[model samples]
Target chain A: MEIYLLILLIFMIIGSIIAIEAKSLLSSVISVGVVGFSLSIAFLMLGAPDIAITQVVVEVLILVILIRATITMDNTAIEGGGGTFPFVVSLVFFGLFLVFSFFAVQEIPKFGEPLMRVSERYLRTSAEETGATNVVTGILLDFRGYDTVGEATVLFTAIVGAFGILRRRGRKKKTEEDAEKVGILEDEDIKKDFEGF
Target chain B: MPDIDEEIRDTSKGMTSIVKTVVRFALGIIVIFGAYIVLYGHLTPGGGFAGGVILACGYIVLTLAFGRQIALRKMNNKAASILDTSGVLAFLAIGLLGYTGGYFFLNFLGRGKMFDLVSAGTIPLCNIAIGLKVTASLFAIFLALSIFGRFISSLVDEDE
Candidate 1:
């Protein structure tokens, strides 16, 4: 199991590298999808089915949205500039991240070992207290209800903002066109003639 | 003859008939499955968010297979906005209902037998509400982004 997880992690790293280095936006999106799929599998192997399910669905949705966005953009422009400075900086950051994560991984409890008090209490009492068999749901919707509300609010705000920006841009374009036509009309006798008609 | 052929081709803006037919056939099952996941969230590994995503995928499939215009006609931007707001409102109302029991988001309703469908009281209700909110919000986001992309592309075309 540990070996399988290690292999999966390696594959995820490969996927991420491909995603970053790919020339085309579509290929990068696909590589990122691969990474997301591997992460979902890791979640499943780690006994978090709910997280795995959410991850898979969210990954698909993100891929679809990204593909749609990229399809409409200039394909050649998706190929980013090759800059050695940015590359070197990213490499240094990657090395630091790797070293930090290696030490952090060492601190985590071994596989199958229960971690501390909170989870134990949640497992024992959540069913009875919340009347929900799924302790995760109970914790999310009951014990941590405030957090869920905050999350929902955030999602709502993001969608509203996106919708507002898109709608506003469209209206702005139309208004600008109308203003231009009005300006053109202002300089002519035809403006008064058209108004009278 | 060329004009007639062009008009015929314009009738279906999506993929081939096989893809559209398959998606049309499968959409109902996908929606039903999402509903099942949401309704049985208390007893299953999936919940509102997961089920909501699945439901949104069903709409996405519809959009992909039948084009944006048809899908938008089915659930337009205005309706989606209304649904999105209502979902959050429903969830807030459910939380507020707990005020009668002395706490916010308290499960005031009776807890039925364990593992039963209706046993998880406000939990299933909350899941359903969240499912609605998530589905509408995701679809709305997708629609907005895609429409924006199309508009931008059209502007680019005009400029060119």
Candidate 2:
């Protein structure tokens, strides 16, 4: 299992590198999807099936959105070579991250070792108190319900923000076109309506 | 010239009929599976988020197979926005109901026998609410983003 995990991690790293380095936007997106798929498999191996499922679905959505966004753009415009400065900066950051992660791994509890007191209590009493067989769900919905509410609020805010920006841009374009037709009565009426609002 | 224009229009919209037929057949199964995941979330490995995303994927498949116009017509932006708002409102209302039990989000309803379909009183309801919210929100996001992309592309085309 450990060997499989190690192999998958290596594959994920390779996929990330390819995604970052790939010239074409579509290929880069597909490579990123490959990395995401490998990460989801790693989650499954770690016994987090719920996370794995969510990760895969989110990955697909991201891929779809990315493909849609680039579908109309000129492919040649998206192709660009990596500059020396970016390469050097990325290498430095990679080295620093590696060192930090090495120390972080040392601080983690050994495999199969029960580490946190909170998790212990959750396992002990979650089923009885929450009537939930799935302890993760119990903790998320009952024990940490407030946090979940906050997460939902964040999602709501993001949706509202996206809608606002898109709608504003659309209205701005329409008003610009109306401005171009300044002499026309209908355009004047539209401008008056906009000003009234 | 007219025949060529018609051909270009048809080809520009969606894929071949075989792809459409396959997507149509698979879409129903995917939706049913997602519903099962949301409904049985308390006992299964899947939950509201996963199931909701899967549901959104069903719409995505429809959009890809039958063109965005048809898919948007089926579930328009206004309907999606309303559903999104209602889902979260229902969830908040359920959470507030727990206030009567002396705590916020407390499981106030009767927790039926363990492992039963109706067991885990508030959990199932919360899952369903979350499922609805996630599905609507994700679909809305996809719709908005795609529309924006199309708008920009159209602008570029007009410029040319």
Candidate 3:
């Protein structure tokens, strides 16, 4: 298991490198997706199957949306600061950050150990109180229900913003310049364009 | 197969006939699987977010397979917006309902036998609401982003 985790982490590092260094948008986006998928596997290896499941699906959808976005635009010219003084300085900072993070990890308890002491109460009472066998779900929906409400609010705001930015033409009774606009594409035109896609 | 293929072509509005044929079966199965994950979240590793994402992925796959027009026929962006709004409202409404008992999001209902489908007092309902909200929100975001990207690209092309 340790070996697998090590391998997955190594792959993730490679994927991150490719994601940053790739010349083409397609490869960069795909590599980042690889990184995401690898992290999900690592989560599963760490005995967090719920996080792994969410990560996998979210990663897939993000990949889809990213690929579409990149395909329609020009995104080939991404450059890291080439071998310059600032680049070297940034690299040193990154190394120092990593070392500090590793040191912080050493200060923490073992992987399976919990320091909060709150989760025990959750595990003991959640099933009886919330009637939910899954402790995570029970805690999220029952004990931390207020937090879920906040999350729902955030999601609602996001949807509202998206709709505001991309309202449909069909929603209106009439438009003075409907057919001439490129934003509102004809059904057949857009459909035929991706006939084989 | 040929008959369906021709019928699909008549629309001239999607991916290759092969993709259309396969998606007919796969899409429904994926959606159903997502719903299962949401409903059984309290008993399994999956819960609202994962299941909702999977549900949205079903619609995303449908759109990918059949193109925007065909996909929109099933559920347009506005409909998705409505569903997205309703989902969060349902969750809040449930939370408010909990107030009648004591606090916000109180587990007022009878805590039935554990491990049963109808066991979770308000957790299952919350899961369902969150699932609905997430599914619709994701799909709506995807549609808006994709269409907006295309529109921007078209504008750039015209400028060039």
Candidate 4:
């Protein structure tokens, strides 16, 4: 288990280094995606299949969005290789990160010995009270339902915010022409799409 | 660099037919799998967010495979926004209904036999609500981002 974790962590670090060094946005995005995928694997190995699955899906969506953004934008600004000062600063940061993580690892509870002061009650009563065999779901939707409410609200606000940004901003004259040229979805669909807002 | 017109033409139609065919073969299965994850959330490891993301990605795959027009026509952001709002509303309504039991989000309904599909009372309902909300939110976000991308590209072209 420790070996697998070490390997995955090393893999993730390598991916991040590549991402940091990459010249183009696309390659950087892909390398970051590698780090994400490896993290999901680490989650699976750590016995949190639920988190692993979420991580995987979220990573996929993020990758698709990043790649789409990269492709659709003008990427004329290539990154310049760093000089000695910036490189030294980054090296210092990396060393600090490594030191911090090493100490953080020492702070973590050993595997299989979780601090169950609160979860013990939750685990025992959750199935009977919430009737969910999956304790995570039970806890998420029942015992800590307020969190779920907040989560839903956050999602709602985020989507609404995104729409607000994407809403028509005085481009009425060009919308139709661009829609036709790009075979875009009809503007009428987009215009009334904000009725929920 | 290639002519903008030619490049747009090539991409706007989406990928090769072979890719479309493969996606078509896989799309139904993906939707079913997502549904299964959502419905069986109580009995399984997954719940609303994961399943919802999968469902959204299913549509996203179609959009990528078939271009934006057909997919958007099938379920536009208007419908997505509606579903998104309704999902939150349904969840709130369920929580309010818990008032009958004298607590917010109380599990008032019957907790039937364990492992049964209909067992977990409001949990299943909550999962479904969350699923709807997440699926619509994510898909709508994708649509918005992609459209925004196109808009920016067009703006750049205009500047040129």
Candidate 5:
């Protein structure tokens, strides 16, 4: 199972890179879906059923959005090879990242003993204190509620930024269009044919 | 688009309108699942973020398979904005409730029972609130992006 899963991970990573680099928007979207599915499976194997389920659900959603967005996209810009300098820089950066990861992994302690001690310490009483069964929930909501609040705030900021840009554009468009005697909409035939978004 | 459009048109021809309609229905069902996942996230693996994305996915799928016009008619941009705003308000209200009870954002609400899906106190409520916010916000973002892209593309074509 481990070997098979490793192979799947390789395939998934390679596929995702290709998807990200692919010129055809449709194919790229499909590849992203494939990557999402594979990652969900990997999550399950890692004994994180909740994470896996969430990942799968979110992945499907993102793919759908990407597909819809792609419908309206130009899809003309295909990534071309960078000049030699940039290529060399990227190679060096990637090599450094690999070495850092290797060192980090080697320095990490074994997961079993530490996790067991922590669970033994607070697994039962944790839910009682936080009023949640899932110890994870207890930690996230009760112990780290501050962090959660910050996270939610981050999400709020992102929404506000996006909303501001879109709302401003909308106001500009409406005002401009209102000044005109005759409003010209996109051709009905073209509108009907448009897909995805 | 000359080549790809032909390919897409040919591929889509093999797919029937019935298939698209069925897909739309499925999307509605998916949205329900999203609601369930988020509302009961305290007990389950899924939470607001995952569920919100799922809900957004449902709308996106319908929009893609059918058209933007159909999506606008069904969910509508205005209604989405309302949902988005209400979600934020609900979240703030819950957080403020914490102050009156004791600490801010307190889950003083008792956990009703264990292993029961609804047992987790304010956690579930927070999940639901976040879920709503996330769904609306993400949907709004994508809708704007899609509309803007189309508008710009049209402008470029007009210039040419």
Candidate 6:
């Protein structure tokens, strides 16, 4: 437990430092991924492996998209560095919260007893009732399927937004191409407009 | 089948040929595994999202080994968009079925005995729908990226 806390502390410190000190936008993005990955590990140790896996997968997808966007855009052009002032403020707030959480952690009843109680009563019946061996899956897809539908909608929205952003410029180009072919636009004007793309 | 993009590589190089062969073989294997994962998602530890991601990864590998034009030739934009829309439609249809059957989104469609590989009521169908939607959405995003990235790069070069 001490070792885990130490590792968490180390990761937090490194994550904060990287978020503050990294020169490139890509490095900062990676630093955030590292922080998220460590938190997922912490979730695992806290007996939430299913949550850990989901968090890790979501983090990976977000990180990949963020990194790709950062690489493709002009990230280094930001004047004062990547929002360092807000970072420091948030870090301080998070640190204070952590210190307070340690004190409050003792008073909180852990998951052990409740999980045990619930598992004893519900584990066997969940499969028979829901037809899923994995209780978490049953809970996610059966008991709380409405919530899953909402989650799927959120994912759908994100993909739609990304598709829109990526498609808009391409569609503009296609229209311009058509205009040039039909002699509605001059070659030089089309070239200049294309150059702005 | 169409003119497609000009072959960006010269076919006269032995080293390039070896690399191309290896890449094609790897991509083929990846696509197979991804398809298997998607098909057997409910019967195993895997599920729709994971399988869809695996399939997308395979598509990406194939795109790298071959090219966007060839990969898109098989998974054209129209086909992918249709699959994506249909998957969502299927999900909504199932939910409506549940509502009609006394509960919202309940697995009310039972064809056979419980505990059978294919008798998970609506779970397997849901998984397949999710897999199709996710794979199509991912591919659509990637297709836009590839096409737009190339377009943007060309613009930058033209200004120079």
lDDT (tens digit, per residue) of candidate 3 on B1-160: 2454454565555568789889988988999999999999999999998999999999989877776655666778779888888898899999999889878889888889988999888889999999998998898888787664454354223323
Worst 10 residues of 3 chain A by lDDT: A170-179
Question: Higher lDDT: candidate 1 or 6?
Answer: 1
Tell how far residue B79 is off in model 2, in angstroms: 0.9
TM-score of chain B of each: 0.86, 0.86, 0.86, 0.86, 0.79, 0.77
Better of 3 and 4 by TM-score: 3
Q: Write the per-residue lDDT of candidate 1 for residues A31-66, one digit (tens) a residue.
A: 999999999999999999989989999999999877
* lDDT for each residue of candidate 4 in A1-197, tens digit (9 for 90 to 100): 88989999999999998998788878888999999999999999998888998999999988987777787667634767769998899899999999999999889888779888889999889988888898899999889888899999999999999998876574465544565677666667756654555
Q: Rank the candidates by lDDT, best first.
A: 4, 3, 1, 2, 5, 6
Write down the worst ten-residue block by lDDT for model 1 chain A: A168-177
User: Lowest-lDDT window of 10 residues in candidate 1 chain B?
Assistant: B151-160
Candidate 1 Cα outliers beyond 4 Å, as residue runs: A76-81, A98-114, A168-197, B1-11, B151-160
Best of the two (1, 2) by lDDT? 1
Please give, as one word, the docking class of candidate 3. medium
Estimate the overall C-alpha local distance difference test score of candidate 2: 0.82
TM-score on alpha carbons, each prediction: 0.84, 0.84, 0.83, 0.82, 0.76, 0.70
* Candidate number with greatest DockQ: 1
Compared with the true structure, all predictions reach lDDT values of 0.83, 0.82, 0.83, 0.86, 0.72, 0.68
True-contact fraction in model 2 equals 0.55
Error at A117, model 4, angstroms: 0.8
In Å, residue B130's CA in model 1 sits off its true spot by: 0.4
What is the fnat score of candidate 4? 0.73
Q: What is the DockQ of candidate 1?
A: 0.55
Question: For model 6, what is the error of residue A93's alpha carbon versus the real structure, in angstroms, after optimal superposition?
Answer: 5.1
Q: For candidate 4, lDDT tens digit of each residue in B40-76?
A: 9999989899999999999999878877665776689
The model with the greatest lDDT is 4
